[model samples]
Target: MSTAAHSLSSNPWKQGAKDALPLLGGYIPVAVSFGLFSVQAGFGVLETILVSAFIYAGASQFLFVAMVVSGAPVWLVIVMTLLINSRHLVYGPNIAPYLQKDVRWLPLMHLLTDQIFALTLTRMPHMTPSDRLRWYVSAGVIAWLSWILGTALGAIAGDELIERWPLISEVLPFALPALFLVMVLPRCTDRRWTITMVMATTTAMLLKLFGFPNIAIPAAAICGALAYYAIQVRPTDKEERS
Candidate 1:
């Protein structure tokens, strides 16, 4: 094996696409939905593709499309997008130890997004830092490509597709979250982490009921991290020493 090849996790763009291939196959419906919805909302192929490629954050992208479709104001759409993808901050620190081997913190955090962070941290812990970074860049950037292509296609071709396919609208919105679910389910071995996650999600639902859905996710995640540290970290640390 080439020392470089053996050193890194894998080529980032390639690894990302490879890992996401199965999920991407499933995501085509979701991508197509974005395309159709964007066109319906006055977005052309260019606008649709820009949102997918640049924003590259799934929940935000879908939420933006939903807002545009509802005839909402542009500012409201922006706020919603920011709120939906705010979890990237939390994802950054969790992966710091692994990436510390090569790059500094800012650059490491630069490429991170919610899904990419989760995918890499859970799956790439044992790989070379180069390979780990490669894997992350892989999924992040390629899924990004898939998103833009699908949206552009839908924007240009959505109405015709709906007239023909009919079922895609119901399914596309679920794609990114489904990919997240797949990533989340596999790495849930830490009981404390699992507890924190469930508690966070439950809290978000309750907060939403109280008329503050926009702030729920970050608030819940913060509270979960606090609760986990308070309840479990000390014991786990002590156990590790023995």
Candidate 2:
């Protein structure tokens, strides 16, 4: 343990890793698939690993690759990417309480992602500042490592595995949705979040087949906002003739 961790401050990095391990176990297949697709799409091993490691955004990165293949304009891709990742802004405040002021904003910013954000938010309400940072960093690092390794392996051996297993062929492409379900369903507590999730699904389906808008990030934000609104509108029964 670092000397710094033993103080009143909880070690954010270590705890983050602990929470992140279980989640990373499930992320393996999806990460590899992404790596496979990225390579097939012409991204080299270095590019694939770097993006997974640094960008840390699977949906946006995948979409970026697809757009590149389609020969979309660079500006359009950039705009779309930003639009898709806009949800990050919301992650800051929700996690702010748990974060240590020890680091500047940039380092903290690096750790934001759907999985980490969701995990941190759930535990943030109860955490001391120290534990929050440690947990988030640890979780983020684990996610980062798994993603890099998974993609590297996927890109290298994607074809062989796909050819060998026919079931993967049949059950293919479900990981993203499955992951989404796992991450989002747990956070649903009110009608708004429910509606938001439904809308995002519908929108994603509608646009994905045709073109234009990307649905993943937008859908997440939509659901998140609606959930927030619904929870806020939570009604309380009035006192009777006090």
Candidate-wise lDDT, in order = 0.68, 0.71
Give me the overall lDDT of model 2: 0.71
In candidate 1 the C-alpha lDDT for residue 149 amounts to 74
* Model 1: lDDT to the true structure: 0.68
Q: Who wins the TM-score comparison?
A: 2
TM-score of each: 0.76, 0.79
Clashes of each: 13, 11
Off by over 4 Å in 1: 1-16, 65-80, 100-111, 207-213, 216-220, 234-241
What TM-score does prediction 1 earn?
A: 0.76
Candidate 2 ranges with C-alpha deviation above 4 Å = 1-14, 100-102, 169-172, 209-213, 223-227, 230-232, 235-242
Error of 2 at 11 (Å): 6.6
